[model samples]
Target: MPHDDVTTPSVTTEQNNQEVLDVFGKHRDLASLPVTENDMPIGLINRAIFMSQMSKPYHRELYNRKSCIAFMDKEPLVVDAAMSIEALTFKAVEYGEKALADGFIIARDGRFLGIGHGLQLMRVVADMQAEKNRQIMHSIDYASTIQRSMLRPSREALARTLDDAGLVWEPRDVVGGDFYHFAAFEDGWFAALADCTGHGVPGAFLTLISSSILTQAIEQRGPRDPGALLMAVNRGIKQMLGQLDGNDETPGSNDGMDAAFFWFDNASRRLAFAGAKSALFVLQPGDEEGEIVDGERMGVGYVDTDLDFTWQNRFVQTQPGSVVFVTTDGLIDQIGGPKEIAFGKRRIRETIRGSRHASAARINEAVLDQYRAWQGHHRRRDDLTFFCFRVQ
Candidate 1:
């Protein structure tokens, strides 16, 4: 809201009508002039009104010798020097046409400071707003870099764990709420997908917090128990967001996440899956339609959600040459196609059914192609993440 004080010069009460007219002739740029007496604002004079009256036949002869106060407008717009531009804009509007014609008086504690113009106020406000917008964009860009840094290390781990895999992570905005994770444990590897509440900056903040808590949970509890990690994440988010008191009636208590977690054990050849209003899929070799693993009906960290509840894990034994898939709801929730309905899970199921034996990478390509074709020109609904890995 900072702005420059654009005040013009003023006139003294001692100036006679003729002297005031002479001042106008000398300075053609001033559309209005403020009159002061004892360094306090007394009145104002509109250039057009004064000039028109003075130019009339015999009018100057009568009023030129009169005191300038006789020709001055008794009431005028007066503004404080320290007034904010936003408040001044409203003041300008309330004053109507006189603000543009005679302008306003800039005063400090009822004493004449200077003269202010409406046009100058507008210019200063515009410049300040532009600068503020620039600063916000710069901060968002920096945050985007930090969010991306969280992804690089996870990719390195995925390379070591899988023979073939594919990942697609797209944020509707430059920084988004959707996030994914992958890491190698001593026995096997773990992966997860989460859709935090909202999108853009707010969502990005949750992703950072969610990702960090997930890493800490994996480190402490190990990746073999995905349900425990989910429980830990639920607790961590509730604690971080100050929603742990379990008061669902709070006005802004709905902030939380929908997530799916997966753990693949090498020695046991089993996959452990846990979810909070999310799901994962397992497609075995030569199978057109695979198993759909539905998760718990409850979501994580939400108001009214049980604080002491444990997420149940569903275990599936791995099949050689099979592919496992997990995704955030962004893709399935997208509104597109001729009917303008959601690109539902059935479409996803069909896309993978056609290439059940292929590596996760090839299957990803096929899905992407169909998704693009179905999406057409529709705007993205939310942040998106889709990840798949071939079981070796």
Candidate 2:
């Protein structure tokens, strides 16, 4: 009778190999080998190597007659548990074709506790990378949530300033450079759409900077005059970048925002809107006719624009049920659906017009649905955002 070891699982090494094969079977980069107490590996076996060996008479004889110990290679590569992935991979690669075997064994006090397989070791490293990304994402989410709270309420929140009101926001990455906020200032609700210079990390930083300035300006002054708020924000951002003194040629690059803002007065049923670089779309009541305010673009410090960068204020007096759409560049920039085409502004206009009667939430959903359909097999390259509301 043979004495059984309690520490070891009852399953045989071959069974363990089979189980490993079943799970990581598709990983061509992996391989397994038998180990010996002498610190030498007997026969080197990979999926390819084993298949070839099985077909040969000489190799079978070699395998059957010799104690796996007889074929042991004197010097086996081993590593500690704390070895960096770079070192582990380098060591694995050092074995050349034999590197596919179980990864470096983790030993403590001169005893083997466990083994790290190639795929699993790589996964461990990947998990660390994923965790870091999650932390970054959480930070961004927090910042955006805080900024959103500072936004003014929608015009519909008061009287019937707009027939309907809603906001649409989608981030390309975990965080986006485009953002929108709503606030009830003097008489009506004030809203804004901001597109910073970049997206993701760089753009997110600029947006925070711009958002803070905007909030402070609003709190200190008021949203009565949209142009004044923007100008103050522009100057604040310039000052932060030390470019407010007119020395455009500096060591670092310029940081600025392209934005549009509107103030809807519920009392007098008047609407005041101003834009830096963003455009506006309005759907008139009881008519299929649409209006596109080709209003001039606005620029902050360090950014250049030729299309009437001056801030122009526009007004519209209306009854209930008028829909207005404002958006950042993200939604229109989505790449590829059928033939990998951009979801251009034209497509957006049609979608909005078609869903004009839908609720704010439904309209938002419809726009995203159109975008997704257009981006069939393609992925979202940038953040997708839009604001839809009807004057009540």
Candidate 3:
């Protein structure tokens, strides 16, 4: 190889082959070497074939440490530098030694330029995967922006519909897995607080799927009833699960959303609530102790219901001045303080109760303030979401 030859790998071809053998150990069944001609890969020699010659008593003296091109078998499979890590993994198992070339040749316009190690090849693959994910997340963030934009109703509409409404949401990542939405149908306002399985991109994707399904159900059913809403969403996700059969270990595949949804009829002042694994608190006016409505922590999705699932419909009567708070576990699960203790449900309750003098928005803000103070640190471990409604 020429000294200035960038096409020649920095390490000698023998060293490159030895390094691969070192990483894979003595398992010829696991690795092989590539043969090339005219700067192009031509064939492969697997470990079994290698050992057949190497084990011969006179093998070393016969070849005289010649060029690698002489040992290559006639036909081989070649992978381009642009192949995905996931794709490459499959190809490794699929094509065997043929895909395991000396090193993936880095070429431009059919001219050999450089070489990439297997792990370096995988990293290149991973970077491409991450870039694809980033593009997808960018799209969702845009959709999240649109969804959030649609959430803002006209002042007159709010006054006419919701009593007093506000929300507090902060994501630990670029995209959040927590979701909340309201829809007005025939009888009353339908609202939901949903927590999907994870935190970042995957979590965000599941929530978007859940959100789209829930929205479509509401749109079609015209906000029939909260119980019906939950049931419909459960069935929808179950159908989705049925369609996705290959990956059995996917998060939220076990069970989808942990949520609480309710239909609050302003005209009748009646509250109907349903849930999967979420909790709801109703703070009574002028009192620290409030009526707590606890629902099954089994949000919408497939569940091991034989393990005692009770989807009960509870009716509650609330008077004007009552405050209803819906929260995702992120707030309670925050690891804060010098000791890194969770903010806890107790702190959350006390904070909400103490902040009664503040506006709905202020109360939400105060909860965050209390969280930061309690944590004594920044960086909430999970996504935090809270929604408050005061019965005017």
- Which candidate number would show the highest TM-score if scored against the true structure? 1
Instruction: Give lDDT tens digits, candidate 2, residues 1-392.
Output: 01113331111223333333343355554444435354422233344545455457766555544443333333445555566777776677776534434344444444444445666655666787799889987987886665455343432343334345666666676567776767764567888888887877777777778888888988888887777777778778777776644456555676787788778787886777777767888887896967876545557644443222356688777557777888877787788766677788898889888998888668888888888888887767777678887777
Q: Tell me the tens digit of each residue's lDDT in model 3 across 112-181.
A: 4444445555565678789998998888788667545544442234446674676776767767777777
Q: Count steric clashes of candidate 3.
A: 8
When 2 and 3 are scored with lDDT, the better candidate is: 3
Order of the predicted models by TM-score, top scorer first:
1, 2, 3
Whole-model alpha-carbon lDDT for candidate 2: 0.65
The lowest-lDDT stretch of 10 consecutive residues in candidate 2 is 1-10
Query: How far does residue 322 in candidate 2 sit from its true spot (Å)?
Result: 3.1
Candidate 1 residue lDDT tens string, 219-239: 899887888999999888887
Positional deviation of 167 in candidate 3, in angstroms?
A: 0.9
- Per-prediction TM-score to the true structure, in the order listed: 0.82, 0.64, 0.63
